[model samples]
Target: MPKSYLITGGAGFIGLTFTKMMLKETDAQITVLDNLTYASRPLEIEALKKNGRFRFIKGDIYEKEDIEKVFYQK
Candidate 1:
């Protein structure tokens, strides 16, 4: 089974690179949990978005509801 990755700061340089590397390796699902803060650029994540395995969520870590929405209740 493919693994799920929750990558914080995923829109930044290192994070974005890691996201791309993961996608290139296989069809693993990745959730980019970035606030899109001053340092982060939405455009940086655009290419990853083109991959079906990549998902971007515009949210802050402090927000509980946003975090909850991403996970399925099992």
Candidate 2:
């Protein structure tokens, strides 16, 4: 199976850039978790949803429930 990657703060510039590079360079399932903070790019994140291997989660990293969604999501 392909590797799965969980990218925190992925809507930020640096994180988003790295995420794109990973997507281009490797066949991996990428999940992005970000709270849509001021530095986040919601529109760009929305575009990432077009790729089948990509998923975006909007929630705070400080929240336990939000983090749980990563492992328990159906």
Candidate 3:
């Protein structure tokens, strides 16, 4: 079975780097949760969207509903 990943801050530099590395090295599904804050890179995240295994959610970590939705995602 393929693994699944929930990556917070996944649009930031280090997070994006790790995400790309994982995408290249593994077959895991990646769900990226990011608020698109000043430091977040939208273009990079958009680029990742080209892959079928990657998903992105625009949300803040402080939001209970957002976190809950991700945790409860299928």
Tens-digit lDDT string for candidate 1 (1-74): 98888888889888888888988886789998888878887886886678788788877778997787568422
Candidates ranked by lDDT: 3, 2, 1
Candidate lDDT scores, in order, read 0.81, 0.92, 0.92
Q: Which regions of candidate 2 fall more than 4 Å away from where they truly are?
A: none
Model 1 per-residue lDDT at 73: 26
For model 3 the TM-score comes to 0.91
User: How accurate locally is residue 26 in candidate 2, as Cα lDDT from 0 to 100?
Assistant: 92
Give the CA lDDT, 0 to 100, for residue 69 in model 3: 74
In candidate 3 the C-alpha lDDT for residue 32 amounts to 92
Q: What is the C-alpha RMSD of each candidate to the true structure, in Å?
A: 2.4, 0.7, 1.3
Every model's TM-score: 0.85, 0.96, 0.91
Backbone clashes under 3 angstroms, per model: 0, 0, 0
Off by over 4 Å in 3: 72-74
lDDT tens digits, residue span 1-74, model 3: 99999899999999999999999999999999999999999999999999999999989889999998787865
Q: Measured by TM-score, how close is model 2 to the native structure?
A: 0.96
- Shift in Å, residue 17, candidate 2: 0.0
Cα lDDT of model 2 by residue, 4-73, tens digit: 9999999999999999998989999999999999999998998889999998888888999999998789
